[model samples]
Target chain A: MELANIENLLEKYFEATTTVQEEQELQAYFSQDNVAPHLQEYQPMFQCFTNLKAETSTRNVPLQPRKNYLKWISVAAVFVLTTSLFINEWNKQRQAEEAFEYFKTTMALVSQSFNSGASHINYLTQFEETTNKIFKTENN
Target chain B: MKQADFLHTVLPFKDKLYRLAKRLLVSNEEAEDATQEVLMKLWSKKSKIEAYNNVEAFAMTMTKNYCLDKLKSKQAGNLKLVHSNYKDENTSLQKEVELRDSVSFVHEIMEELPEQQKIIIQLRDVEQYDFEEIAKVVDMNPTAIRVALSRARKYIRQELIKKHNYGVS
Candidate 1:
């Protein structure tokens, strides 16, 4: 608090070399109502700082929880939609497998019935060949 | 972050945010809007806010950026940097500012300074942020911040001295 110390600190202050503690010391020195005669000029700067700090917002808008609700709702909706799509995809795959089984059965039955009809046509061709042989023998 | 937790941690610095925005934007309404906008932005980023070591500093930077962008926008060109006590920058050297009577004389000096120095003074002297923290807000190195801060302090000191000597006679 001596004059010499104040001057030294003020010198550091202007150089921006003062530590926070040193700056606080200077702030404390100027804040006193009865400052030294020589230091009166520097008093107002710190005083202005104090006054600036005093000014605050008249209305502080509290953080709204509604934001969280909306965010969570969107997130939840997305989750549900994705889950439903996944289940639908899974169901489609199962239905395809079942429909493939039914198709295989129907295709197998059609192939078996077509094979029988083909055998009857083979027998008719054999009978036609035997009748041709008989006609040739009679002509000879 | 929880709502109650936000009120405890981030909301504590609302006044600081308001003051910073006020210093940058120079209009109470704009500053108010900036502060609210920053807070709301922070509110949504509550999950990420916890990752920051110093949320207040982060918020300060947000306010600074928001105000700067607001100033650069076309409509805010009319908004003065500070109280319009200073019409002419040249008169500050010759004019005798009544310092003791008006604490706002400091603000007048502030208005005349280059934008960077004005902000450095606000962050360092008024807001009392540490040098590193100021560096983060201003996007400058700490050494650069210190130099700017010193230069700003010196300018204000010289101006105050001039006014003081002028008043004495």
Candidate 2:
């Protein structure tokens, strides 16, 4: 690229009007060993950017340890919840069976009481029949 | 988003995130802390990360806000202002010393810049972000961002030239 173009690009660069390509051209020009004397002062400005970009933190990102623990905690919670639900279901089934058994016994007791009451009514009817026959013989 | 997806999509820009944090916070340890804090916050909200148009811009904004808030807090005293991190290992010893000195000078001038310009310079020059991206991160319009960036570059150039002519010669 011509020095004139670089100069124009540099102006556009400082004005924040350069496209990324033009800025890259400027960066390319400055990065070289043979920069023109007039443009030497601006070298450090872009060089500083390169230097800053090179700076990196070696620290490892601690991602999801707490989240991992939370994951396990949720799994455990779900397991506990399901187990409790199952137990509740079993308890309900057992209660229903007990209720059915109690209901059956009560029904049997009610039927026995009804049968005894019907037998007593039948004996009263037989006695009434015997008294009516005795009155008929007296009248004769 | 899944953990792997979040990592693939976002972790590559960690350095850019770190650079922005360092630019604002000015301390290596604090910047690292800020970066990690921002990443963790992003990770926590990974489910919603897909909702953002640009996760990197959102992350940059978070780092900016966090560093600014840190500066306003009691820990503001911890702010180191500016420290030179540039070291050219391939150069001669004398050139290295000279480079370090010039870098120190630049850091001094950078510390003198207003916070907005300082951030703009970092985003534009160091991170190489476009004006549109910077507008999103800084919450300024594109034209305003361009103007602010130009003003910043002009100020730095003037100061650097002044330092070069007077300090070197």
Candidate 3:
């Protein structure tokens, strides 16, 4: 704020002993329109620092987010789980259907053998009846 | 680290890295590339970055080293290291500098300084880094850094006063 103080700060600044706060005060003092004429020569340096500080890189920094991998992993996990579950269920249904087909074929074979045996039994019964009729006629 | 963590921690100071790279390399495009390279390096090592006590300081050191390497390998013929080579080195970068007035004049004067001195001034005066932090970035002790900074500040002052007097005359 005071000329004497700025001169003192400038002296400290050039000595590279000024604290950051003190350096900021000097910059603040110089940035105003009414710097002391004697110190006008020093103004550009501080202003240049300010201007350089304001200079930003217009280039883009590409930082692809890391979360995408996690998202894909979870999605992959869900897909595997559903696919396995579906396959498991389908496998069980197929096994049951195969077992039923085997049972039907086995039952049909057993019934076919039993039906042939029943037809032979029917012929034996008819022979027995014919024999009994002949015996009855002979006894009469 | 996570991208969000990196964005909060490292990405915030990218401009600081850019400014330091720009100051050292003296070309916006080179600085931008250097900054991107440094950032990509940091990201590659992001998992271990948390091990650092000061990530920003580490990033600054990386930028400084990267730009110096770039200058040595690619632009050794074109880049100036001292005032003697100032005229030859002052080509495309000089025309591209956007500062319009006395600030530009000071910038030119700064361009004449030794590379180390220019970096010290940029880190201390423009970036507001403390001496210890600057010591880490520049690989100099705090006392040596202070001395170099004082010399640079005084050099700028002498040049500015000379220019002012010449203008008045």
Give the candidate number with the greatest DockQ.
Answer: 3
> Model 2: runs farther than 4 Å from truth?
A65-140, B74-96
- Model 3 agreement with the true structure over B1-169: per-residue lDDT tens digits: 6788887897678999999988877777778889999998898788899899999999999999998888787665785433222334345755534433578789988978988998899999999999989999899999999999999999999888887878622
Q: Determine which window of 10 residues in candidate 3 chain A has minimal summed lDDT.
A: A59-68
Q: DockQ scores for all the models shown?
A: 0.45, 0.41, 0.46
- lDDT to native, each model: 0.82, 0.84, 0.87
lDDT of 3: 0.87
Error of 2 at A36 (Å): 0.6
Pick by TM-score: 1 or 2, better one: 2
Per-residue lDDT tens digits for candidate 2, residues B91-143, read 99888677657666676677678778888888888778888888888999989
Native-interface RMSD of candidate 3: 1.5
Task: Name the regions of candidate 3 deviating beyond 4 angstroms.
Answer: A65-140, B75-100
The global Cα lDDT (0 to 1) of model 2 is 0.84
Q: Model 1: residues >4 Å from true position, as ranges? A: A67-140, B74-102
Q: Across the candidates, what are chain A's individual TM-scores?
A: 0.48, 0.51, 0.47
